[model samples]
Target: MQPQLLTVPAQSGPTEAVPAVRPVRFAGLRLVHAALRRDLARLPNALRLLQPGDEPGAEALRRHWDFLTAMLTCHHEQEDRRLWPLLRRFAPELRLLVNWLEDDHHNLDHSFTRTTTLMRIATRDPASAWSVAYAVEDLAARLETHLRIEEEQVLPVMTSLFAPQSRVGTLGELLDLLRLADGPGAPDALAWLLEGVAPEQIEALIAECDDLTARQWPHWQAVYARCSAELWGPAATVE
Candidate 1:
């Protein structure tokens, strides 16, 4: 199933007062979450497939590992540096839950480091693939639990903050606080979100972009198609 890049909680509350929902307003965050979830679940099986010394496949997985960690680090850094701090200021009641999530992020590091190490070894020694698979599966399990909590507890508060009556943070301010803007790999990162999404849905997302991004839509797709093909084989190509 394709993730809905943009989100409105089952209830929009006051945001409905706005004329339209821009993808940047909420979709950027959800897209990052979706991409993380997708890769965590996928990496274990992908590693298992390379147990027979498939060096090219292993290298592809390694590049993707770099992407996954980069995204995860940025997401956590922003949440810790920006998003949680905002919640701390405005939604004091959520402090305990937010703290737990923050701690969870730090606690996952041991397994993350182990998985990263195993991934590098697997690239050279086929026998190490199982080790990588096990490590990733464990990491995925922990991350899934973390994401479930965030989606259930944190996101609703975020959604409410977008309401018209909320004085603390407007959507634009929240987006800025989260620092969802482009940095290194910005194009590929945006392109990463659209992979495997339905064509019509992709068009809908692009429609909400600003003029410059709307113009660059084709190039993003081409880049994603190439990346997908390399990571998952020819079968994964958009064509």
Candidate 2:
């Protein structure tokens, strides 16, 4: 069940009597999730392209993997610290589901850690790239499941919880906080999330974000473009 990445709000079906999951913020999430799904879907092949003892190639991939995981960690922490707590507080009935999603984040982190370890090993011994590739594939599969659950079950609840009249800060506020929080991979994170997004949408999203992102958008895009093409090769679409 692929979540369509669009600004148009779509109903995820209500968990109780909540708003439909149609908000700009949710669109931002869907965009990020879409980028994750598309890129990771192709990651195994990219990993496989590394030749044995190709230290340069393995190191390059390791750098790219580190960037990706840094962004992933930031996203996971946002959900864990902010989103999940609100859910547990307001919707006690969905505690079991919330717990599962929270567990997924932690478990996914462990899996990501394993992949990082393998990436380091591959950097030294490129023959181990095969193992790293399989590890990524496993994480990608789990992520597919996790993202689907978030869309299917959590969306409606979140939509209701963060309704317009609610006193809680908007997604933009949280993003602003994240930007100022000295978060890891901030520029790279924006670049990664903006992948495959339209130029206009990128502009709009950046407007909702920070001046730093707006000012550095082009540079971020350029860096990511070069790094991604070098890592994933011509077969992969750089944008």
Candidate 3:
């Protein structure tokens, strides 16, 4: 007797083949690049909120803070779990860089915590907003520099060392982490990243989600839609 091949029903809606999972080296760099752009764009708006006014800037600042905190935390977690171990295995010479990166993460966390505390204070006492704004600005500058160092010095080494199989596993790990960390405001943060990416990069990201489940699809769509509208005005739309 011939064995019958079991077939699953196709999901409804726009579906595309999932691209090969991004390489670990490339994925790390892309994630950081996307995140940095979002934070930089929002920094000005957040700073503006500190200005003495009855305007709705406070809400904006709070939202920006929430987004940044979540993104940075998730980024660091991915590095700690996926990136660092692979680096230790592939390029042991770069252990120093990993150490430095870890230290920088701690330093960045301190700055973020300080900024968050001050922002909370400013909520009730608008007079204190300037101090919080200054801290946030300083942190943003530091983070930008840190990202550049990782991109230039660290990622290339990783790209050279990680095997293709490892890269696929690492990419899967990253996606799992992001899904686990997704909160009420995650879509907004993702939207912020999406808006800053070039057209081609946007297509790449969509391609990354090609195999996403039917349930996960609508959540992402809603997130992309709402975030685009809020951050980029009416021009924001998923392509």
Candidate 4:
């Protein structure tokens, strides 16, 4: 369900800390933002290889675009389904900001769709390579803006709301929220999520994952490592 932008509650001082049985703090959100930034930063280089005279294979580029789109879609869907409603309920003061984030999601969806269309065209018509590259670059610019705002404003609000002592505090809840529909079994998505996250944060995320995720993670890491090297060249960072 969508948020009601109107009827916002008045901001009354600091909210009382709700007691909790198990106080677990989750840092998945910040790490996800970092992952997005890393991908966006590398995107320009990926696209640059597609300049008019460049010889990057169209099919390979299309696959790369598809992987990126899938990862981003999964991240946004998880936030929309699990994060926003919780924010609206517990952090009433951030209601307007939550609504704005929802709006940002919609805008990002449009950009993704447009970029995908360009990618498809480029797949069939190599002459359209520059156009596809331009589209991706544009998407990166918009995504970067959205991400900066989210990290600076929304993340702190989430940290305060989900503090360790909070009644709602549970790493499981946030970890589950971070999960995509394909679950933790999908190597590409998992790799993308872990990319650019700090070592400690990765440990924290792994600690909160289910048994199956923990069991499969090492194997998937190895598989994606090989795939990344093949796709981005040996020197490229896998994440």
Better model by lDDT: candidate 1 vs candidate 4: 1
Best by TM-score: 1
Tens-digit lDDT track for model 2 on 103-199? 8888998888987888787677766667777887888998989989988888777777786545233435445545766565566666666676665
Tell me the deviation in Å of residue 112 in model 2: 1.5
* Per-residue alpha-carbon lDDT of candidate 1 for residues 95-133, written as tens digits (9 for 90 to 100): 999999899888776567777888888877877777778
State every prediction's TM-score relative to the real structure.
0.80, 0.79, 0.71, 0.72
Ten contiguous residues with the weakest lDDT in model 3:
1-10
What is candidate 2's local distance difference test score? 0.70
The Cα local distance difference test for each model comes to 0.69, 0.70, 0.60, 0.62
Clashes by residue pair, model 3: none
Q: Count the backbone clashes (under 3 Å) in each candidate.
A: 0, 0, 0, 0
Segments of candidate 1 deviating more than 4 angstroms: 6-25, 51-53, 164-183
Off by over 4 Å in 3: 1-25, 49-57, 164-172, 181-189, 213-239
In Å, residue 195's CA in model 2 sits off its true spot by 0.9
Model 4 residue 222 CA deviation (Å) reads 1.2
Q: Which lDDT value does model 3 have at 126?
A: 70
